[model samples]
Target chain A: MNADAVPLLEARGMTMRFGGVTAVNNVDFVLGEVELRCLIGPNGAGKSTFFKMLTGQLTPTAGTVRFRGEDITGAYPHQVARRGVGIKTQVPNVFDGLTVRENVFVAAARLHQARTARRIADETIEHVGLTRIAGRMVGQLAHGQRQWVEIAAVLAQEPDLLLLDEPAAGMNKEEVARTSELIREINKTKALIVVEHDMQFIRMIAKTVTVFNQGSILIEDDVHTVLSNQSVRDVYLGRQAA
Target chain B: MAGAIASGWASFAAMLLAGLVLMFGLPHVFDLFGLLQMTVFVAMAVLALSQGFIWGYGGIMSFGQSAFFGLGGYTYAVAVMNLGDSTGAVALAIALPAAFAALLGYFMFYGRISDAYVGVVTLTVTVILFNVFNSTAGDWYTIGNAPLGGFNGMPSVPPLNIPGHPDEPLDPGQLWYAAMGSLILVYVLLRGVLASRFGRVVVAIRENETRAMLLGYDPRLYKLLTFTLGGGIAGLAGCLFTNWGSFISPTAFSLAQSAQIIIFVLVGGLGTLLGPILGAVAIQYMVTLIGAQQKVDGNLIVGVVLIGFVLLVPQGVVPVVRNVLQRLFVRTPRGGTAPVASEARP
Candidate 1:
C-alpha cells in the first residue's frame, strides 16, 4: 500500500496564533511511513497546539500540511480521520453508558465495511489486553485502563499515522512500562506521533525526538543526542539555553 | 427471565382488563363525564411518550411536543371534515399527522439544531402554527377557517372515515378502540427500536457526544433521526386525539401542554422506554384522584407531586425501581464481572 512512498505526513512551516500569542510558530515536521516520532516540550511550549493542527482540530495560521503528497492544509478533523489518521486524547472520551464492545462496534460502524469491523475491534482490544473489561461500561474505568482503551480505539481505525496525546500521563510505573511497550509494538506497523512529558517513556520508544520551545523546534535529533545536548539540558533545568 | 416476562404480561393483562371494564361500564357505573375525563388522561399519556423520545433517550430537551400534538389533531380534523361521514378516512387521519411530523423533524434535525435550540425552534414553530391557524383567511385557509374558531376552537369538525362503513361515522367506542390500538403499537414499536443496534448508537451519543464524533459517527445526524422518528410517533397520538374530540384548537399547542409532557418523562425515567407510559398513567391517575377531592386544586396537587418526584427519584420511577430490585435480588455475574471501573480501551 505505498508504504515506502514519500513521508506519510508533512507539516511545512506551520504556525498557529491565538489572538496575540503564538502557540505554534512555523514548525516543520514530517513523518515517514512507520516512523515513530516523539514530540516534547516544556509546559506551555505549544506541543498540544501542534498536535491539534496535525489532526485538523486547529487550523494553522500559515504553512501547508501534506498527507501522502496531497495538500490537506485546512481539512476538518473527521475528514482528516477518514483519510486514515487516528487520534487518541489524553483524557478518556468514550460512551460511558455503553459496554466496551459496543463502543468499539460503534466506531467500527463508520467504516461501513463488514463483520471485519468487529474482528478488528476485538483484535485491537485483545492487543491492549482489555478483554476482561470488554463488557464493562467505560465510565467506570481507572485512569490507566482508560488510556489503554483510548489507544485500542485509535488502533481499530487501522491508521497510517496515529497521534496520541500523553498516553502515559496518569499511569503508575507499571502501567507506564506496559504503555511504553505497547507503543513500541504499535510503531512496527504504523507511524505514530506521541506527545508526551514522560522523558523516560519517550526515550524508551522514540528513535527520533523533536523538542519544541515557544512554538518552534528547539532540537530534532536521535534520542541519545537530544538527551545529551547542552541546549536540551538547559531548557529542562529552567535556564536560558547556552 | 421467563418468570419475569410471565409476571409482566400478567400485570399488563390485569391493567388492560381493568381499563376495559371501566371503558365499557363507566357510563353505567359513574357518568359520561367520568369516561371523557379518562380519555384525556390517556391522550396526554401518548403525548408524554413524545417527550420521552427527545429529552430522555436522544438527550434533546424539547419544549415543543405540544405543537406536534396540535398539528396531529388539526390534520385529523381537516381530513375527517373533508371526507364527511366516511369510515375510510381513518387512514388519512393517521397519515396526515405522521407526514407533518416528518416535515417538522426534517427541518429541525437537518438544520443541525437539536439541543437547546430544538426546544426553542419547536416552541417558535408551535406558536407560529397556532397563530397561522388562528389568523388564516379565506382561500388562504383550508379547514381552520374564520371566525377561524378563535379561542372557541374549530367545532363540528367531521368524524373519522372508517372503511367498509362509509355511510356511518365512527362512534366514541370506535375512537376509543383506535386510540388503544395506537397506544399499544407505539409502545411496542418504540420498545423494539430501543433494543436495536441503531438504538444502542443513540444511547452512546447521549453518554458521550465528543467520543461519538471522534469515532466518526455524527451526533447531529443521529439526533435528527431521533427527532424525526419521535415526531412521527407523537403525531400519531395527535391524530387519535382529534377523533376523540372531533375538534381542534390553539390550546392543543400551548406551552403548558409541552410542560405537562416533560413532567411525565421526568417522573417516568428518561432512558427507559416504558417509563414514560408508566409515569403518564401514574400521574394521570393521581391527578384524577386528587381532582375528586373537593378542597384540592388538581393542578397544584399535580405540580407538587411532580416536583417531589423529580427531587426524590431523579432517575424516575422505573430506574429507581430497577435499582431497588437489583439491590434486593440480583447477584453479580460469577466470573465475568469485570472491575466496575475497568477502562481498558479495547
Candidate 2:
C-alpha cells in the first residue's frame, strides 16, 4: 500500500450521546487500504456503538466519517454500502425464511444483472463451502451455519471494507476455526474491522488491535503489544480469564 | 425461498383445472342465486389477496384495505356517472387508490414508523373516510350528476356496459364470467410477480429490513411498491364488487368491512395466495349460513371461529396441509438427501 494513498475509512471526534449518557465519546479511528483490525472490549465499553456509527446504523452526535475521501457521516446504511462498505451486524440478521442460496442471491443481485447475479450467487455459495446445505432454509440451519450464510452474503457484496460484529459469537470450535480462516482470506483483498470477544479467534487472524474502554480508545497497536499490555489485561482480558 | 416456491407442472395443472371448473362448470351446477353468491365470493377473494400479498409477503399489516376498496367504488360511481361509460370508470377505480397508497406508503415507510403505528394510522384513515362519505347526504354532496347518497348509498349503480357499446350492459351470467376471469388473472399476476427478482427482494426486506438495508436495498422503496400494488388490487376488487351489488355506499369504507378483510386473510392463511382465496370463500360461506338463522349473531360466530383457528392452526391451513401432504407421500431420498421442495417458502 502506498503511504500517500487516501485511507479507506477515517473517523474524527465521533461522539454518540443518548440523552445524558454518552455511549461513545470523542472516538477517532482509521483504517488503511487492506488491513484486519480487531476491536476488543467488555460489554458497554463503546466498541459496539462505535461499530454502529462506522456502519451508518447510527449517526454520531458530532463527527465526520469519510470513506475514500468522501464524507459519509450520517449517510443511510445502503448509501454506506454503495460506497463499498459491507456490514454483518451483531445478531444473525439474515432472511430466516429464505434458503441459503436465496439469501446470497439477494446480496449479489444488488449490483449485478439478473443472470450474472444468479451465477455469482451460486459461485459464492460454492466458494463458501455451503454447497451441501445451500438448499436448506436458514431458519432451520444451526447457529454456525446462519453466521456463515451472513458472512457469505457480505462477501458476495464484494465490498472494499467489511464491518463484522461478533461473527463467531455462538459458533462452535470448528466453526470458529473456519471463520478465522475466512476472515484471514477476506482480509487479503479487503479491509476488515472485526469487533469480537474471542481472543483465540483474534489470535488466529488479527494483525493490528484496537482496545476500547469507557467510550474511548485505550490503545491501538500490533496484536502482540496490545495483548501484552497490562492496562488492557486489567480492563478486558482479566475479566474473561477470571 | 421466494424464487424456489414450488410451481411444479402438476400443481400448475391442478390450479388451472380448478379455475376452469369454476368458470364454466360451476354455473351449471349452482342455481342463479348461488352463482351470484359465488361471484360475490370471488370478488371478496380478490380483496383477501390484497391483504395476503402485503401482509404475508411484504410484512406489512395494513388495517385499512377497505379505504382503497371504498375509494375504488366511489371512483367507479363518480366516473361512470360523469363520463357515461364503465371502461373509463374501471381505470379510474384502480388508479386513484394506487396513487393514494403510494403517497401514504411514502410517508409511513420513509418516516420509519413502527408496525403497530402503521396499522393504527391505516385504520384511522379508513375511519376518517367512512365518516366523510357517510355524512355526504342530500343533493349538496353530488360529484357531477352523481349524488353522494349519504347513508342511503348510490343504489342501482349502473351495471358495467360492454366496452365501445355502452348502451347494452352485461347480463348476470356475463358479469359472472368477467368476475371469474378477473380472479384468475389476478392470481396469475401475483404468482408471476412473486417469481420475479423484485418480489424476491421485497420478501428479503420483509424478513429483515436492517439486514436488507445493509446489503444496499432501500426497504422503503420496495415496501412502497408492494403497498401500491396491493392497493390497486383491492381497488380492482372493489370495482367488481360495486358491479355485483349494483350499489356504492359509505359502508364500503366502514371499519367492519376492513376487519372482515383482515379476518379473511387471517383465517385463510397469511403467506400463501391460495390460502386467502379459500379463506374468503370459507368465511363468507359461514357468514352466509349464519345470516340465514336469527338466533346467533354472525359476528359472534366469526370471532369464535377466528380464535379457534388462531389457537389450533396459527401457521394457517396451507402450510399445515402442505406439510401433511409431504409426510403422507413418503418419497425415497434421492442420493441420500431429501429434495428441499420449497421448504423455505415465505
lDDT minimum window of 10 residues, candidate 1 chain B: B337-346
Predicted model with the maximum TM-score:
2
- TM-scores of the candidates in the order shown: 0.85, 0.96
lDDT of each: 0.73, 0.87
Error of 2 at A173 (Å): 2.2
lDDT (10s digit) by residue, model 1, range A1-242: 25567779988999999999999999998888888999887888898888778777788999999998888788767678878888887577776766676677667767745367768777778889988888677777888888887888778866788889899999999998999999989988899999888887987898999999988999999999988888888786345333
Q: Compute the lDDT for candidate 1.
A: 0.73
**TM-score of the A-chain for all models:** 0.93, 0.98
TM-score of chain B of 2: 0.94
True contacts kept of each: 0.40, 0.63
Please, what are the lDDT tens digits per residue for candidate 2 over residues A1-242?
A: 57799889889999999999999999998899988899989899998899889878999999999999899999999999988999888888898888788899889999988688878988888888898888777888888888889989998988999989999999989989988988888888999999999999989988899999999999999999999999999999998899
